[model samples]
Target: MNEPMDMEAVLERLKEKGLRLTPQRVEVITLLYQLSHPTAEQVYSLMSKKFPYVSQTTVYSTLKMLKDLGLVNELTYGDRSSHFELTQEEHAHFNCKSCGEIYDVDVKDAHQLQYMLHAEQGYQVDFVRLEFYGTCPACAAGGKSEADAGRTKQ
Candidate 1:
């Protein structure tokens, strides 16, 4: 499981980036801190409950800014819409086909693989993304098969 995000650090980073600490931006960031693998629309929907006037554009722009700042990551799996998560230590992702849930997974020797690729293949690795797709524990317990991987959220 991922640790809770440090809101103070996020605010400090925003200040360092010379960005204003607007209410909308704060709400969006707070949502990112709380949600795991939420899409842009999901963020907007939750934020709208508090600030009913909040626009989807605001969510998208805030997410884009955070992505540009390397504070968040957007993931797209199978045929689902993109999901957002806070940038953290190197890790992989597991997508549950039956429930459409995204889970964080620890990757072993991830850095070694990057180093090996750089030393042996002459490739300068920027970052690595490893994703696994299959039925989750609950799905498996329910006797769901990999063919049910077609289930996905927009």
Candidate 2:
């Protein structure tokens, strides 16, 4: 993972976009900054604990505004719920099937791929998202144990 973002810088950027600094917006951005990629519901649940007055609609609208302002990125893994994360240096995502943990993966040749696509296909790619799905280390090891136990039973 890359270094944590400076909240002050993010706030300054938001100001430059002519967005007023509200408590709910600050809470949502802070949570996004801390947690890599969290669903809108996840963000609402966390914020509701401290700021119970904030509603889900407020969170959703705030996220949409932030995305439009280029402060946050909306991500999906073909799941029922969409996820949100603070925009950082472009990278890929790894979804663990067992643990349900989302991890960030840096793609070194992303620019090269973009260039090739534009040159060969005459395509203009503004952004790219790559996702890999698999069992993580803990889940893989646990699955092996289960398989071994099933063999013993047989």
Candidate 3:
């Protein structure tokens, strides 16, 4: 897989788009690029550790701005909070029902799927999101699902 984009280039792109390079923006960008998939609250929590003065509202606004700029993608997993990630690459995601973790998986047949859809239905698609829901190997082996563990403790 290709390496994720460096934060420097991202910041430069943001600046090129007339957005100020504020410290809060930097923190949010770093979190979105570093953390696999984080929600606004998670980004704010991490930013608070580094910049205690940062607020959740700031993080939300920054994330919204980034999304508007097409620099990030907002993903929804069931009823959980929305997760944000850099839009540097096109890939599929595997949602682990057991642990609620999202793992990236290669979409080896994306092009084929697109072709099939167009040829079959005479449609043109811009982008596709293919997500699989199942238990990850770790959870299937010996790991207890989060809900199961919580219930046992109760």
Candidate 4:
């Protein structure tokens, strides 16, 4: 994977997409670029620290706008909070049950999967989300707290 993108490049891309470049929008984009997949509350909290005037509602709305413009993707694994990430690459996610960490898994057979879905189900799939839940190596080695066990499926 390439290095995390800079804010100027992100801002330029947003402008190309016809989005207005406001301070609130820039802050939200910066947080998303830096943190990868973060929940709205997480973005709001970080923005609040640096920008006391930035509101949660503004962040939420900005995220929605970015998503609509195909600049960002949203993921929800039935978790309490929705996660947002930049849509620069396509990959699946592995959610560790014990550590509560989300790892990006490269999809070597994405085209095959898409072909099978289209051939077998006759569904024109525009987007796909594949999540694998399991105990990561550290958690399996008893590194995580006991309370974290069995929280997700493998």
Candidate 5:
């Protein structure tokens, strides 16, 4: 899995991609880096509190741009709203069905799996999605779930 990226490097990438560096965009990136796997609505709510002039449309547009630029990853849930994170490494996800939490899971043999599928099954590999759904530890303990716990597990 990927580590925390340097903001300066991210800015450089933005410049390389010909994306204008704006205050709103910076805040959006910071928020996603700070609060991993946050929904667009969650971002809009917090951004409104910090920068009242920042609109929901701006947040949506910023997220869209970030996704298109591969600076962020969008984690979608079947039963709940989608979440976004700055962790863009090739890792799998674990979704807690009971508590609605998403955990990052690193697949050590992801490349091997792709190779096996392509060589053995004659299936072309494009993108792979690996996610596990189950009850989190805190949910098993009847308490709030900690995102760090999931991160540590991986």
Candidate 6:
């Protein structure tokens, strides 16, 4: 899943999972593969432009199905709506505190930590999802929003 999947690859995955294919579902999978990280609403919005009668339920259900099948991962940060991305190699995520942008961060140290815990504590390693919060370069270099203007370092 690290590599971007073509339409046939996506369809084959759905078929392997015993899921029926429909035009709307195919569109949803296409968006999931194309968009960097999208919420259910964003998927619905884009699909609506093409399929005017598509329902939010359809979008949510499809996302749920993808997640259940392990083809996609859902990232939940605080109270915000979860974001979806194709399943990929383990990596960390950075959340820009000011603008709420999420970026993928390659962290070799994460693997080292997992190895250490497994070797020393006899704990089995599953998966790692580390979230770091900070101001992105754009927001930190004197590009603060009006609301952020009132905040200060303690």
Off by over 4 Å in 2: 1-5, 142-154
Model 4 Cα lDDT, one tens digit per residue, 1-154: 4333566776888889887898889888877876746778888888899889888899999999888877788887664667888775667887887666666777788768988999999999887777889987878888776444222223
Scored against the true structure, residue 78 in model 2 reaches a CA lDDT of 56
The Cα local distance difference test for each model comes to 0.82, 0.77, 0.78, 0.76, 0.77, 0.79
Best by lDDT: 1
Query: Which scores higher on lDDT, 5 or 6?
Result: 6
lDDT of 2 by residue, 1-154 (tens): 4643689988998898898999998998888877757778878888999998889999999999988977788886555668787778888877776657666788788778989999999999998887888875757777543222101111
The digit string of per-residue lDDT tens for model 1 on 1-154 reads 4553588988899999899999999999888877767889888988899999999998999999999988888887656789888888878888886777787878787779999999999999998998888878868798655444332332
2 or 3, which is superior by lDDT? 3
Backbone atom clashes (below 3 Å) for every candidate: 0, 0, 0, 0, 0, 0
Best by TM-score: 3
Q: If scored against the real structure, what TM-score would every candidate get?
A: 0.82, 0.81, 0.86, 0.79, 0.84, 0.81
lDDT of 5 by residue, 1-154 (tens): 6774777888898999998989889988877766647788878877898898988899999998888888777877665677887746678877777766676777798878989999999999988878888887778888864533222112
Model 6 has an lDDT value of: 0.79
- Ten-residue stretch with the least lDDT total in model 2: 145-154
Clashing pairs in 1: none
TM-score of 6: 0.81
Residues 48-92, model 3: lDDT tens digits: 999989888899999999889888899976686798878767778
Tell me which residue pairs clash in candidate 2. none
- Deviating ranges (above 4 Å) for candidate 3: 143-154
lDDT of 4: 0.76
By summed lDDT, the worst window of 10 consecutive residues in model 1 runs over 145-154
- Ranking of predictions according to lDDT: 1, 6, 3, 5, 2, 4
C-alpha root-mean-square deviation, each candidate:
4.6, 7.7, 5.1, 4.9, 3.4, 6.2
